[model samples]
Target: MTDDTPQTRRPLRVLAAMSGGVDSAVAAARAAEAGHDVTGVHLALSANPQSFRTGARGCCTIEDSRDARRAADVIGIPFYVWDLAERFREDVVEDFVAEYEAGRTPNPCLRCNEKIKFAALLDKALALGFDAVCTGHYAQVILREDGTRELHRASDMAKDQSYVLGVLDERQLAHAMFPLGDTVTTKEEIRAEAERRGLAVAKKPDSHDICFIADGDTQGFLSKRLGRAEGDIVDESGTKVGTHEGAFGFTIGQRKGLRIGTPAADGKPRYVLDISPVTNTVTVGPAAALDVDALTAVKPRWCGTAPSGPGTYTAQLRAHGEETEVSAELVDGALEVTFTTPVRGVAPGQAVVLYQGTRVVGSATIASTRRAVAAV
Candidate 1:
C-alpha cells in the first residue's frame, strides 16, 4: 500500500516572516496555497513595544503581532511571535548609532535584512528543519538549470527592493523565497488580494521611515543614544563658518539644518561635503562639491560566483537612485566603482549594489569617495 498519511509523506516546510502588513499576509497565504506547510512568525524587535502602532505607518508594535496571528488564522497556518529584541539592538540599532558616530550614513532596514532577518531568522528556521524562509520582499529568486538561484528585480520596477536585500549570498539565496516577487505586480494588488481573503491589514498604510524612532526625529534619537559631541562647521579652506551642536547629526550632501548665519563668498547655499568624526568637524561646501567621480568599497558580497576581476556593470548607489553605467575593478581587496558621469550624494558606509541588467549580482559597502580635484 502507498503511504499517503500526513505523518509518513514528506511536505515542504516554509517559515514566513510576517510583519503585520498586507504584503506578508498575502505572502503567507500564497505559501500555503503552494502546498507548503507554512508557519507565520512575527518578530518582536522593539525593546519597548508599543501597545498599538501610532497612526497607520508604525510597525513591530503589539498590534502587528495580533494582526499577524489573524492572518495566520485566516490562512489556516501556525503562527508564533519571536522575541529578537536583544539581537536587533546589537545588530541593527547599535550598528546604526555607531555608523553615524563614525561619520557614515547607515541604512538600518538593510542592516536588519542582512543581520537579523536573513541571518538570524534564517538560521533559526533552518535549525527547526524548515526548507526555506519566505518573506514579502519585492524581489524574485529564479532557480536556474545550473541549480543556482538568481536574485532578480521584480516586474514592478518602481517597487523593486533588490537594493536593500543586496547582502544575501549564495547559501542564503538557495533557501530564500520571495512570494511577492513577480506575482504581486503592485502594492494595490497585494492589498486587494488580502482584502479578498479577509485579511484585516489590507488597507494598512506603509511603515514609517524609521520604525525604531517612533517620533521621526532621527537627530534627537541619535543624540540621545550617542551623546552630543559639539563640533565646528567648516568650509573647503578650513575656515570655520559656523558652529554645530553635534557632528553625528549631519550627513554628507545635507543642505538644511546647518544653522550657518552667513553664506559663502560665492553667495550660494552650502551643502555638507565631509564629516570628520575624529576631529568632530562638519565641513560644508558648494553644491558641486557633492559630486563623486569614483567610490572605493569594502566588504564585498557576491550573489552567486565571484567575478574574476575588472569589468563593466550597472552601479546603483542609493536605494531609489538611478542606475549609472560604470566600470568596477577589484584592487587589492576592495571594489573600485568608477563612473563615466559624476554621481551625487555618494556617501561612505552606504551600499553600492551592482547589477547585471535586472539581476543583483554583487554588492559592497562604500568605504570612501574620490571627487574631482578641480572646482565646479
Candidate 2:
C-alpha cells in the first residue's frame, strides 16, 4: 500500500510463535506479562523431523513441541502445535536448494520469516481473531508519536535479528510484536528471566546454524539432493586451476572446501569470486576480487515508508554483518545500492537490509554485485 504503514491497535490479543528456544519462551512470557491475551503456537515445520534433538532444542522435533507446551503452561496460556511441514518444505527447503542450484547463496531463515512465520502463520492467527503475531526476533516495533510503527534493531547488538525481519511489509508490521526488541535487553537477561519464571527452556541452547540440514554438511546435503555436475574452477584469465563436483555446493567468498590442488602462480590464497550455474563454473581469485562496488536489489519492502528520494543509509550484506554507508536510489523498479567504500561477499539472492540509524527502513533480494574496476 502506497503511503501506508502498520498501525498498532491496543488491547492486544497476541499469538506468539514459539520455537522451543529460550528466547521465544521468554518472549512469550513477556507478551503475557504485558497483560495481553496471549496464546502460544509452535509450528511443526519438518514433515519428518530427524528425531535427533526432539528431546531438546530442535524446533521441528516432538521435544520442541513439548518444550513449547511447557513454556505456555508456565505463562498460563493455551498452547497448540500447527502442522506446517508441507508448506515449510515447499517454501523454505525447496527455495534454498533451488537458489543454490541457480548459483546464488540464499538465507533460509529470512525466507522462513517472510513466507512462513509472518505471512502464513500471521494470516492464520488473524483468521482466528488474534490481533497480533508475537515472536522472539531481536528487533523492535516502535509506535512513533505520529501513529506509525517502525521496526528497529534490537538493543543487544550481538543478537539483533532485524536483518531477517526486513522482508516484513506494512501489513505484516501492523500485526507484529517483538517483546525482545528492547535495546537494553540482552539474551542473558532473557534467559535469567526464564529461570526466574521456572520455565524449562531457560538453559536450553539457542538453535544454531541452518535448521533443516541436520548434520550441517551443506555440500553433502545439496549434492545428494541436487546431484553433482562436474565443473571447472577457473581463474580471472579463464584458465582452469582445478575442477569441482558442482558449483551449487559452493558460495561466494568461500575459502575452505575448495579442493584445488594447484596454487595460483602469485602464491596467495584464493577465494570464490563468482558462480555461474549456466556453465556450472566456479571462479576463484584473490580476496580483493571479492570487493563489491555496487549492487542492484529487486522488489524492496519498506518497514514503514520508503525514503522520498535517494540518500545515504547504513547497509548490511549478511546476517549480523557490519554496517557500511551506502547511497540508494530507485531505478527501473530495482533498488540500486552504491557503497561509498567497497563491501565484500555481497551475495546475490541474500537480502541487503537497509537501516537509517537504528530503524530498519527496508530490504531487497540482491540481484547482482558490481565489482570494483581494480578487480576487473
Candidate 3:
C-alpha cells in the first residue's frame, strides 16, 4: 500500500511599487485580482526623514505613501514604505548635477530606473523572498521561443515608456512585471478604474519627471549646486557674441536664452552648437550646424539574447521623440547609428535606444554625434 499526500503549489507573491498614482493603484488591484499575493510598497526619496515636497503628487512623499497604503487596504493587501533617500541622492541626484556640469544633458528618470527601481528595489524584493517585482511602467516584456526575454513598446504608443527602460538587461527583465503593459488603457481609463474602486488619487494630476527640481528651474538648481561660474557665448567662427550665467545652463541644440543680439552673416537665427566646459564657452551657430546623421554610443546593453551582428534598426535620441529609421553597425563595445535621412538635433550625453520593430534590442550612452559629411 502507498500513502498519497496532496502537493501544494505556492502562491505567486508580487511586490508592487506604488507611487500613489492611478496607474500603480490600478496595477496592484489587477495583480490581486489575477490571484497573485500582492503587497504594495512606496519608496521615500526625500533627503530629510520628515521632509516631503509640497504638492508632491508623485512618489516618495508622506501623502503619496498614505495614498498607497489606503489603496492597499482597500484591496485587502499589506503595504509598507521603504526609505531610499540616500541611494536616490547618490545615484540619481548626483549623476544629474555631474552630467550637466560636464556639458551633457542627462535623463534622470533613466538613471533612476537603472540605479533605484530595477536594481536596488529588485534586489531587495528578491532578498525578501518575493516571487517578482512589479511597476506601473508602460512597457512590455515577451518571452521568446528560445526562452529569452524581449522588451517591447507598450500597446499604447502615446504612453510608451520603453525609452527610459531600454537600459534593462536580460536578468532584470526576467523578474519584473509591468501590469499596465499588455492593456492599451489610456490615462483616463486608469483614472476611471481607480474611481470605480473608490480609491483616492483617481483625479490626481500626473507628476513631473524631475520632481526634486521645483518650478523646473534647472539653471537655478545647477547654479546653487555648483556655484556661479560665468562664461562667454561665441559663434561658429569663434567670435564672442554674448555672456551666459554658466555653461551648465545650456544644452546642445538650444536656440533660446542665447542672449545674442546681432544677426548672423546670413541673417539667420543663431543656435547653440557646442558647450566647452574646459574653456567655459557656449558656442552658437546657424541651425544647419545642429543637423547630425551619425552617432556613437558606449557601454551598450541589449535586451534580447541576439548576437551583436550588424542590422538595420530604428533609434530614438530623446524620450517620446520620433523614431527614425537607421542602419546600425556594432563595433567593439560600441554601436554606430547612421540615419537614412539626415536627422537633426542629435546631442551628446543622451541615450540612443535601438529597436527592431517594436522590440527594443539594445541601448547605449551617446559618446559623440556628427553629421554625415557625404550623402548616401
Report clashes for each candidate as comma-separated counts: 0, 2, 0
Indicate the residue-level lDDT of 375 in model 1: 71
In model 3, what lDDT does residue 321 have? 96
Worst-scoring 10-residue span by lDDT in model 3: 1-10
Instruction: Name the runs in model 3 displaced over 4 angstroms.
Output: 1-11, 49-58, 373-376
Order the candidates by lDDT, highest first — what do you get? Answer: 2, 1, 3
- For candidate 1, the TM-score is 0.95
Residues 20-134, candidate 1: write the lDDT tens digits. Answer: 9888889889878877799999999977879225666567898888999999999999999999999998998899999999999998888898999899999999999998788
Q: lDDT tens string, model 3, 1-376?
A: 0001010023468899998887888888877877779999999887663333446423567777788899999888999999888999999989999999998888988989999988999999999998777888888877765667788899899999999999999989877778788788879999999899888879977877476675467898899999888889988778888898899999988988888877788888888889988999999987777788888888788786645567899888899899999998778778888888887777778999989889998888988888655432
Instruction: Determine the backbone clash count of candidate 3.
Output: 0
Residue 349, model 3: Cα distance from true site in angstroms:
1.3
Model 1, runs deviating above 4 Å = 1-11, 51-53, 374-376
Error of 3 at 260 (Å): 1.4
| Highest lDDT scorer | 2
Residue clash pairs of candidate 1? none
> How accurate locally, in lDDT, is each candidate?
0.85, 0.86, 0.82
lDDT of 2 by residue, 11-95 (tens): 5788999988888888889888877799999999987766324233246777788889999998999999999888999999999
Could you tell me the lDDT of residue 331 within candidate 1? 88
- What are the root-mean-square deviations of the candidates from the true structure over C-alphas? 4.1, 3.1, 4.9
